[model samples]
Target: MWGGSGSGVDYDVMEVYHLPTGAWDQKPTTGTPPPGTWVYSSVAIGKDIYYFGGRGAGDSGYQYQNSLHCLNVDSFKWRELSPSSDYDPMKKGFCGIISVHFDGEHYLVIIGGLGSSSTPKQPNAQYNNSFGDLRCNEIHYYRISSDQWISPVVTGDRPPPINDFTLTPVTNNTAVMFGGETDNGVSNKLYMISFTETSVDILEVPNPGGSVQWPEGRWSHSSVLITTCSGPHLLVVGGDYAYDVWLLDINKRKWKELINLPNNVTRRYWHSLSVWSVTPTTNWIIEFGGLTEYTDTAVIELRYTSDIDWSTSVIPLDQYQDQLRRWILSDWENLGLSKEVQLLRGHLQDRKREFFEEQLQREIKEKEQIQQDRDKEQQQLLQEKATLSQQLDDATTLLEQAEKDKSSLELEYNEKLNAKVAEILEEKTQVEEKKQIITEDYEKLKLKVAHMEEQYLKEKHIIIDDNQNLKSDISEKDKVIAKLTSQVEEQSQNEKQIITDLKEKDLHIAKLVKERQERVLKQPIKETSSIGLQFNYLEEQLQTKNSKQDTPFSRFLILIYLLFISFVLSTNYNSKQFIGKI
Candidate 1:
């Protein structure tokens, strides 16, 4: 259920009742939602539920809206749709809305409603009660695909200007409308409404044959269309000051009263009924809240079955876990650690995986440090090798210089020169061996460094992927936890309307009692004829004034005074004395 007024809830709340779990969960919404409304016309087409024209308390005060809003159940987001053209639908509440498909295009058709127009073109709308309205025969439609409002040709005797009626669609081209409050009062009659490509026909269904008992006139009653083994049947429930269940067979055009209900479905009005299960053998329908007798009476169901060996149990889509999660995502915030010890065992394995990841990250850092140290050692070894080569070049140049001066000092130091050259040649061989060993060590260090770098890069990539996965897990959990964190967009209905309605009911009851007493006293007078006539005339004047201006206990003093005067005149059998006292 979407937006409604109730005790404690003020704003529009998207509440989901899980049948399997038997829990009511409020789904948080996004975007601007329509103000909390009652008597609004809403029709679900595919996944989107469209809410149109309802009376609500806005920033500007109590207003009857002509605004259109859409809610996508999947996303729990609301969108206020702006009319494409300057001309929009009428500002109304208690209107009838149904989706009609023509040429594969969907349109929202709004029938008769009770409200006023900005221009008030119609001097009097429907029974002259709802003045400044031009909406009796007016049929407004919205092109769902194009976001545009268009007018269609409407025909037939549209059910006399009505509101708060129940419209149940039985076929693609038709629907059945039940009781509604009209300028003529509550209607118990049914109107078979048919739709064409560009026009609608609303004609009354002839009274059921055989003088069967008719469902009493009512408005704001609940009805749903269900298919039984025999065919489709329309079952209607309680209405204002009513507690009766009535059923209609479509093919036969007959009415059947379902009496002796297992549970007492007390008198209620403005309630709602939705078909819970539809099968050839049996059908179950669920009834919801409305103005009831008292707090104790609530939540009734109507079940009708054929039971001809054709029965199957079907699970609703909401019973599935994944989709239900989306509907109740707000439930994750409050978690009770009722089984702390038991839950710790379940998370032990996960903690081990977390430890392994940490160890891998540390190993990668150590490998990186080793790589830096190896690079420095390799550079030092290369510098030492260059120094060794330079020393060998100096030794070779000294030997060549000695060869050039050999003739001059041939015999003088022959033994000494030979010994020194042999020593220098041995030294060169040792230096070459050292250089070869140094080159081999540098090659080993280079291969080790390359291996460490490759391992580090591979480990680093794995950590990056792990980090991304963790981020994703956090994000998904955040969405689940964000359900009721904020409801700044939520708004509620004002209490003034409820107060006014209650006062109206109280005042009507008072009027009924007053008129009943008057009828009893308005009889032919015997001896006190003149006083009785004067009393009746005075009473009529009071009634006229009260009708024009109904005030709370405004006539208390007047009623007491009138009663005293009537008593005096009735007691005094002599007319002359009564006139003198007056």
Candidate 2:
């Protein structure tokens, strides 16, 4: 229904069939578009029809095109989509690329296709040879919002390498992939793939029971999904040069053969089928051109539904008037015209007439001016020509002498030129010899550089190993230093406890001496003297014990301080060395 060729030539114009008038209307298009092509992929989403990847106009063989184009169905205008940065322009073009829309019609999933390494002159030649290598298994999707192609990571079982398959949407997120022809042979296996924003899931469906007969392996078939009173089912029409119709109940996953197709129906492949939902419960499939049992043609629906009950049509006379009004408004905006266009046009006409009159008058004046100038120039030229003639006579005499001198000069120049050429040749040879020597030296230098690079890599690895060993040693040392620091802190705490105990003992002793003095004052004089001597002796003993404890503690402090200083100095020295190496 979109684009096809006839009689070994492709058409560029778009035409629509008017059911009311029962005639074809060749719609005018805007913007440049490629020539007509078959086996290209086209999908309708809203008011835009997206076209991608088709063969060029060649009857025997064709060149592939890897371009994306879109047509506004409402405006009947064609515009090429700029290839996104993610798309490779140099990739070979292909046909029979399967695509499906998901994510609320924001993405188009492009699946397997047939491509070649180089453009061949004949399609038969491509299939006969190099078909295996030409098949594509990569999956890419076009994001409508951002207008970019994304190659998604697909998981689960992958479909076989095949092209020219039918992909019919079963639900919002899923599509039923039917038979496709491959290099191996035609495929009868059915598979389903679920699409998401980031990935795709593919699973092959097992055939139903033996009671239900299945369609044979085929490709280039047409399948359309239509909803009936019971449920939605898939209708698969002729494929691989056979006129057979099959109905598939998607929910039951079973196939039922459709009966009573017209007897004169011509089997076709590589054709297109489109559905027209006329009412809430009725739909019709419109089939288009492909290779029939005989040849290819720009054919429309060969078979028609006789009893298509169309209670109302989507297109009407009022709709056409609305479209006309919109088109007029759009054309006015595009041409930068306004209500003042008519007024401006009239003003231009007046200005043009005035300009012609002015031009005529100016030309008349110019003619008079030219005549006077010509007369003046003729008189001057006559006078100058007479003077030039006399000069010519004088120059003729010298000219003879000049000619004689020219011959002698030319001979001398030739000799000089030959000598110069010889000198140049000798210089060229010497320079070439010098260049050879320099090249030899450069080669030697290159070898030396390579050797040096190898040596440097070995040295670098050695240095890395040494650095790792140093780090391990440093780690171990750090652990030891932490243990020693903790021990020092514990010892300092023990010393503080000892000093506190000593102070308490001194307070107790002083209290006991005071009590003895009070008791002696109350007793006899002899008793007082004895008590005093005992107290003095006890004081001296206590002082000796204090000095003994202080001496040992002070020496221990000095030793600990020296050890701490040595540990800090060693740690600093090692840290500096490590940092320098790094």
Question: Top model by TM-score, which number?
Answer: 1
Candidate 2 lDDT by residue in tens digits, 1-582: 466655643255676765322345677778766533656677777788887776665456665565677889888788877432224432233333344556455676666666555532221122333343466555777777787867677887677556788877766678888887676788878877888888888888787757776777888888888775556677787788456777676776777666545422337776767765433344545555667744322212212122222121222333533433343344444456776555554665676578668868978998999999999999999999999999999899899999999999999999999999999999999999999999999999999999999999999999999999999999999999999999999999998998997578657655865675566567743553464466456556655656666677655643553454334334434546433532
Worst 10 residues of 2 by lDDT: 296-305
Each prediction's whole-model lDDT (CA)? 0.68, 0.64
What is the model-wide C-alpha lDDT for candidate 1? Answer: 0.68
Tell me, by lDDT, which candidate is best.
Answer: 1
Predicted candidate 1 versus true structure: per-residue lDDT over 242-334, tens digit per residue = 678888887777787777553335466777666644223345455667777443323333344342222223223344333223222222222
The clash count of every prediction, one per candidate, is 3, 0
Clashing residue pairs in candidate 1 are 10-492, 11-491, 11-492
Model 1 poorest 10 in a row by lDDT: 326-335
The per-residue C-alpha lDDT of model 2 at residue 138 equals 57
